[model samples]
Target: MNTKFEELEIKLETKQAISDLGLIDLTPIQALAIPKMIDGLDFIAEAQTGTGKTFAFAIPIIEKIKLVKETQSLVLCPTRELAIQVYNEFLKLVKYQKDILVAPIVGGESYERQFTALKKKPHIIIGTPGRIIDHLNRGTIDFSKLTQLTFDEADEMLKMGFKEDLEAILQNAPKERQTTLFSATIPQEIKRIAKEYQNNSSIIKAESETLTATKIIQNYYVVKKEDKMKLLERLLDISNMDSNIIFANTKREVDEITEFLREKKFNANSLHGDMKQKERSYVTSNFRNKQLNILVATDVAARGLDIKNVGLVINYDYPQEDEIYVHRIGRTGRAGSEGLAYTLLTPRTEHKIKQLEKFTKTTINKLEIPSEKIITKALENKLIISLKKEVVANTNTYDKIINEFEQEGISKDALLNALLDKLVPSKKVYEVIEEPKQKKSNLSDFDNKKKDRKDSNRKPSKLKDNAVLVKVNLGRKDKITPLIILDMFGSIYNIRNNNIGDIKHYQTYTVVELSSKGHSFINNKTFKYKGKNIKIEEV
Candidate 1:
């Protein structure tokens, strides 16, 4: 336990709640941000996953909250799952202060239920920006009494294109209110928002080493993009773990991976934003209960989830940003437990491995796929364990079947061999992926230095086999966001929202991942959105 926590002079109620949770020491971010936030100064904190940023804000907010429950604090998150997570964290922190009720209002959930919750007069309401905007428009929410306003994952909210909604909410907020923002990265947009909406704010960050997932054992194997599934199959076949998460870059890929794994007899499910609330709940519950061994998800959909005991994390698709790479691997190695993470890199993405290493400040060792001998040995060991279980007084159940086989002149040895043939899969060669015989001078740099010029609106360049980075000529300057782009495509071309991969926004324009599904249709032409013709070019 750190003596600094005692110095904060936290209330007994919140302290007891913390003790009950077995939280003896404060994380660095919590230690710094908690004290400042509790002091009622506007604040900005740069925090990463697994860094205890939620508790940093929750602790201070809970301590200063009024007991009467008139909406003293409001937290806005980027996704329904994250909003719910913050709500639950608040509940835990205020366990002793029963008067401090908390509620979650997010999209994809029934508004009537939230309205009923609001009527109870929760002391704090955590919600997504859109739903909160809806409530504000309806005059159902009362921020007149709100003293503390927070934006968790502020960077993500901007990425999802909630700048206008956030701004509108800020415009309606009390100027004297204490404002706070926490994000994994402090982009220029975040800085601009702080300047516009917050008073002079103190910035806080932990030591650089504390921000990355250094505890997890990390490795990667370079493979042709087409051979990724073969590597995944080999990993699953040889792994001794109970549950794992396979992260993809897009929802379409999530479903594809899930479907492929299911066909291979692996218990897997897909989790993404497109799934209904109930469907997501069902998938998450089964995963937590160990009914599902593998979960394939995209970054946005996997946010704020706290599933435990995950033994391995697979980056099936290379993440688009450094923060995303850290977040994906941070799913494991939680709670001081040992965990392993693997990345499958293609020639186009192999460069990202170096960037990942630089960002995490750790070595990512090269991992070779299991050799045939190792695979066979693992399979034999698995079979032996099963045979051991069956040999222990289960013969009575097989008596009838054995007699039938004997009458058919099928010996026990032959029957067992046939069973083995069905249970064990045939071996195939996984092509060895060798690094380029020639390396570039900047091969070790992780920061993406070569960027398409904003003015370089030339024709689309040749992309990797199935993915294209298309630049759209509308960005934050034009009040553009990913949702607007998605909506335009959905309405105009009958395109599914998930067909595109990660949507990266710039000041004057945006870059979108046109995967095979999208590449087949996007004509590199112009389309009008909001009365302006938006042109797209290949980058």
Candidate 2:
């Protein structure tokens, strides 16, 4: 087998593209599939996600397409997210080749834009089945010139109920076109499609002992639903992950998690089905460029995304299906590189952990939540390291400042402590404790708060001279408890709990007290809680 891409006898331009991508050697799937693809043979490949399968087929398709202004290849994916990902990969491979145009045609995007792109006569089209069928029906796409067709994630397409769409596409394509199908599993549906469309096709499978690669270390933490967010924050703080993807089950969860992380000042963003095409593109591009540190996305939004150096993957919500669990964790640990995956589970979902471990045929070790002491120590260590770097980088400035402080009768220790306090403010550290059981006082406390608010004519608590009252359009109706609001304001705006004076919850609105600085930060800024935008205004 050829180790380097140049050994595959590809054009110099294609080889240069590979080198530009900084890929020195081919992955196992790529090493196996690229040679046969380059030989112009139809085949079915079975490989897990994150095995560099996109390049396996893309390199050959790029090599075979003529420079003529006509569509010569079609790559069909299950979702728009996957389609765009494939198109982006094609763009990278054809970066130096100016004549080749690759267009993504997917649903939920402007048809006018896709039609305009078709007018340019792209050499390759990557899209979903439904959108491709739309173009085919409208006479907007010409498959007569097509020479190669690929079905990426074939099993997923079938699962997404695209079997009819796939049939329509295959039947309409020219019989002379070379067909290739790639899937994680060789189910009967995939085999049936292969038997029907592929001719004399080779079957290549990258065999692995487990569903998940051995390079990925799997772990799980059990916590209550209410404490999930706190646990996540602690895990991120202790682990100090560089690049990570957090997967949720629904778009709502994605939005909520993204909002929470952003409030906490983490470089985070969200991607899901509800977002427009342009918005999705922006998020994906930023993530690929490392401008975003954390991406909160649903499974559909992350399908076929192949960003490298994903140090960790957090399954904030346990997946419903076994395959989803496999795919979610597969985002990390690519190309034989080591990675870590953590799943947050509640007591109700604890049994599912065992089922997942059994299904993956791998061990998932239980991880203990970091203690408050551990987190505080980690923060201290980080602060010391950053201070050391600053001191090394500006020794003369620090010396001058120290001498000035000395002349002012200030001790060096006192000067440093003052500087440290300004740099890192003390906040309440989370304790490594279990969720408290429900108590009658909880309800009584809520009732007393409500009574007090009503007695005070729904006015916020007496504020300091500079304090301001701000109203948020979330209340008891939307499960907006006082604790939730407090956490948000404290984390997002860096307002200490003590600084948050009074919170009065109404039917559809809530008023809270904030210091002048906190009020300024919230004055013109919009906040999102649980996917709904909340307009904060002075009352």
Candidate 3:
């Protein structure tokens, strides 16, 4: 059992602030770790995400921090987003503690602003490892008086290749200070950090009975890597998601998915660690405000985001760890509302679902990719329902206009056909997309696509016959194979590896033959390789 916030040995202001946030009882990690950390003992905590580990460490930092402000506490995080989020939480909890100042030091923000904030001698420094290390080297930060130290998400920091920076930062900090390292999982490197850096510390695990939310209908699709995007678009169109999140593993993937969705006329944007704070704030605000309906993001949005009312989550790429999977899906199905999570898996990664299922202690139901016809029928049903709602509205003016059209020999059936044609799309969005079994998009897709089109000296081959042949700038000189060209087509256009017939590569361009069925895959629409516009024209 955990004690109430009022019972904790803390200042009246701190207690009042915690109470104001509607937090009555302490979380398991807080009850276990706070008392130990407040006692000035080095501690190692293994806790799951969203288990109140923030408050666990924050409460102790507030209780033990002195009024004399010269950087008394330092908390290092893996990413700028987490650092900013933690800083915001402290800002709220310390609302009544007027004199105790805190500052966030993260990359992608102005150094002059950080220099100004550091000159104020803030009592708490919440920052990413890289920025903190830079400030330390610039002599702008004085951790000599650091009385308390914490490595929040220690596992992530190490995974981000920040071990050297961590060692350097730890070395510069006062050895006599109280230290605590908190992580969702305890890997060997995290254990090594605890052993090498801290005094004798005790381990505390805050495991939950269930790893994920029961309200989330978790499902995995064993789709090929090339077909993931096609299936993603189909699901979004038919599922009717509101403010949904699409998670990808890399920043490049984030950009690619967001770009692809936008090209297909979905209201979507990308979020990742590489974005500036203002850029991130804008994207999140738009998402939270419902101005943007779909958010294509990296795992940076998973850890500490406060956005609510997510209707669905789609993992464009599966994470290697169960913790990342939990956090990714945790963005949805919050506050008792039901949500759906769909994970796309390739043949090689199909077994990882078993691993995630074992770790989460829940069955991950297998999902089938809905065919194009089914998705179109579902969308048409929605259109019919929406149009039926108009039957109740007063239509005297429209009826008179229709009467005139009837007099002009246009049948009511003809009018209905016109409305249907105008209201619904003529073809499925995935018609031009190639669903494939193997091959993936390159990291430099956007740049390479544009460069190959714009800067190349090659010209389009003249049509010798009505045969379907498309000429592209990438050829032998670009170090591309026939399979590579087919994969590129598979990634964007709706064709398969078998659909591509003969491939003749020259120094400047490659001419590819498409079977008669795949000829319709060529389009003049602004197709996006990765947010940039490209086109495939018929020869």
Candidate 4:
């Protein structure tokens, strides 16, 4: 445990909560941020994933919080998954403290239940921008009593385009309230936001190692785009992988690839924004427990999720930014354990591959896709390892069987060959051959979360105008089915089923009907398919 934690543990109820969570020491970020946090000075902390930044901010916030029925602390996360993670962490730190409520108000949850919880008057509320905005507009939460605000992953929140909502929420809170922000990098926008709202804030960047995932054997595959899935299947078939994760850029791709893997008999599942909080948690837990072998996910859905024993990470779709690239690889190779990261690249995306190399500063050596011959060899190697293990273990259990075989006039070589034949797979090397494809899908779309469209000049629709023409940069060739697109939007944004009118899957882009709650709700943080960075606008 870091000495810093020992210093603060003596002062608050959070100490017991930390002990319960089995966290005895402060992480590097926690060590530095906690001291400034306890001093009540506004601060911005720059730290990466797995650095315990949540606890760094949460411990101080909970310590300062005067436990009561009324709301006193507010934490805004960029995504529902992240919001829940932060909320749960805070709950652990404040578990033994009586009358302290840590309620999560985020997109994709039941409004009535949240309303009921609010009536009981939570001591703290942690939520995403859209849901918090929803509660603010509905007057479901009383921010007048709010004394502390923390924006976890502030850069990511900005990337999701929550600047307006964040500004509005801070404006509503008391100026004297403590403000804290944590992010992986100190981008210009982060600096700007701090300057605008924070009063004489202290800036602290954790000097700990920035490279978080060193145990992973990072490599890339230079395959034609169409052959990526075939390669994925072949790799899983032969490698001794305990579990795997595939990262995609869009929610639609997550659903499509998950179904494809399932059809091929892989125990696969997908996680993204469209899923309810319960479903997301269930899938994540299953993946972590090894019940699910393959996890297909979007970057947003997988944020702050700590899943151990993930032996491999496949970049089904390359990330747009360097930070995302780092975070994805960081998921594997954790806790001093070795891991493998496979990147499938197409001819067109070769440039992005080089960019990633420069960003990570680690040479991703090119390797051939594992052929049936290579896969068979890998299986043979595994069988050899098992054979060696059997020979070295306590031998009394197997000695009787060997003696019986000896007495039956079985020669040693014949007996050993017979046993090996029974144990190893019968498929010959040639029979296991899988033909590589000429090309594969790119599995990426124009940044939907960053795209934004302007409000149309057309008059508000009448009863028959149920069709809302929202656009996305996915089409037929990209393997985007209607159900997949719907699931994507539903998971990533809070778009309801009935709100969608008609969906026209164009060759290059898709257009769909607007849901019942038109402009006001659609324009909020619930929908990220807008902005100058991405080209999304209403017709």
RMSD, model 2, all Cα superposed? 18.0
Q: Candidate order by lDDT, highest to lowest?
A: 2, 1, 3, 4
Separately for all candidates shown, the number of backbone clashes (residues 3 or more apart, or on different chains) is 2, 0, 6, 20
Off by over 4 Å in 4: 1-4, 9-13, 16-25, 95-99, 274-282, 347-358, 361-363, 387-422, 426-539
Q: What is the overall TM-score of model 4 with all chains considered together?
A: 0.73
- TM-score winner between 1 and 3, please give it: 1
lDDT: the better of candidates 2 and 3: 2
lDDT of 4 by residue, 1-539 (tens): 45645467444666766766666667778888887877878989988886778888888877777756678888888887778778877777777786677899988888999999889878888889989988889888898888788999998886665767999998989888889899887876688778988989878887645545556688877666566777778767776577888999888989988887897888999998778778988999998888888999988889978677778888887675667777888878776788788877765555466556765666777777676667787888899998889789945666787788889988778988987898886553322323335445443443211121101111222224445455565564566566765676676665766666556554445566675574333331333332312233454
Q: Write the per-residue lDDT of candidate 1 for residues 1-539, one digit (tens) a residue.
A: 46445566889988888888888888889988888888898878999988888999999888888778588888999998888888888889888988778889898898899889888778888999999999999988888888899999999998877877999889887888899999999987788788888888778887778755657999888777777887788787777578999999878889999988898888999999889889998998899899988999989888988688889999997777778878888888888888898888765556667667887898999876677678778877887887789789584668799999999999999998998898775665554534434245453332233322111222232234577677777886787766787887678767675567567666567978766766655567887877998887676
**How many residue pairs of model 1 clash at the backbone?**
2
Off by over 4 Å in 1: 1-7, 378-448, 451-530, 533-539
- lDDT by residue for model 2 (324-413), tens: 888888878876689899999866555567668877889999877788777777877888898889778984646787888899999988
lDDT of 1: 0.81
Cα error, candidate 1, residue 121 (Å):
2.4
